[model samples]
Target: MLQKADQVPAVVAEFIGLELDDAAMARVIEYCSRDYMSSHPHQFDDHVLRQKRESVWQLPPDGTASKAIRFSAKLSLSPALRARLDEVWADTVQKRLGFESYAAFRRSLPNSLGVTRVD
Candidate 1:
């Protein structure tokens, strides 16, 4: 969540000695949101639903609120979406890091995938 990122930015700023303003906050949140959504569909939808159902809420840890009240957004894909995403992740790893093994691919997945990470 962006709230968790507030401390991250401050720490990063301290280390790098750079200040992050509202625009930087939004940019980082946006990037993280996309990655988070792509990685966790169940959690993303549940989070949006809970936010919509809340009549009032305490501010998130970072104190910056989401502009969108509800995340009714949907990512429509053909039935091959899962296979495609996996293939892409594998190819990306191969190209980027020279990983070329079934074990390496399996290791990259979340534990929910229930596959052994063996090389």
Candidate 2:
């Protein structure tokens, strides 16, 4: 996937008008790998067994190279984890904007929480 990203980085950057620095991009990729990929990684094997509970797949569009790998990325998080994600998102925005208060922050931008106050 990073290799695919390499093919279109400049074109993407041009459209977004945001300079894509290597370090920043790599950090974002690394963070995603830690959170998502670390839990469920692509697994492929031959002579498959019936007990491992792994998904077997054969993808199309294999004109040149063999797409011989696939996996079931099944993940479920509790409600507490979802709320934690909201907190993390708010923290990231607050740090980036240096907002005085959460209510002021919402007023300064678009409000999606639908709450009159954020205190």
Candidate 3:
């Protein structure tokens, strides 16, 4: 979806069998964009998840509680963990996705930004 964000409005309109006007189509595209979605993470109800976690798990809210929405591009896995993920991806998703490896799949994406090393 991030790779072909410009086509999202058309795809959604087609799926819903609705003919959107120019203004509506533009609005849909904007609303579906990564930048818009990231800036408006509250729409995903992270607060509700935090509340549930607090009540059910008896966990105290931390600094990260207010920042639950995370983009994968900003995350980094340890080398061992990444290798394990690649192995899993190759076994499960590589054939279906037509990608040789997980790294190759990530490279194929447009503007991956950059991964932040947690180590």
For each candidate in turn, the TM-score is 0.30, 0.24, 0.50
TM-score top scorer: 3
Per-residue alpha-carbon lDDT of candidate 2 for residues 1-119, written as tens digits (9 for 90 to 100): 33333334445456689776888766645534433443443332222342222334433322232123234465888999978866886788667877645667767864333335433
Q: Each model's RMSD to truth, in Å?
A: 14.2, 14.7, 6.9
Shift in Å, residue 63, candidate 2? 33
Per-residue lDDT over 1-119 for candidate 1, one digit per residue giving the tens place of the 0 to 100 score? 23354345445565688877888866765655645556655544455545654535653433323433334566677869967866886788778876665677666655532334444
Over all chains combined, what TM-score does candidate 1 have?
0.30
Off by over 4 Å in 1: 1-3, 19-79, 98-119
Local distance difference test scores for all models: 0.57, 0.50, 0.70
lDDT (tens digit, per residue) of candidate 3 on 1-119 = 55566886787688789998999999988877767776886774478778788888988866243332446556778999989987888888886888887567767765332333221
- Least lDDT summed over 10 consecutive residues: which range in candidate 2? 61-70
**Sort by lDDT, top down from the best:** 3, 1, 2
Q: What is the lDDT, from 0 to 100, of the residue 41 in candidate 2?
A: 36
Cα-lDDT of candidate 3: 0.70
Which portions of model 3 miss their true places by more than 4 Å? 63-119
Cα misplacement distance, residue 72 of candidate 3 (Å): 5.4
Candidate numbers sorted by TM-score from highest down: 3, 1, 2
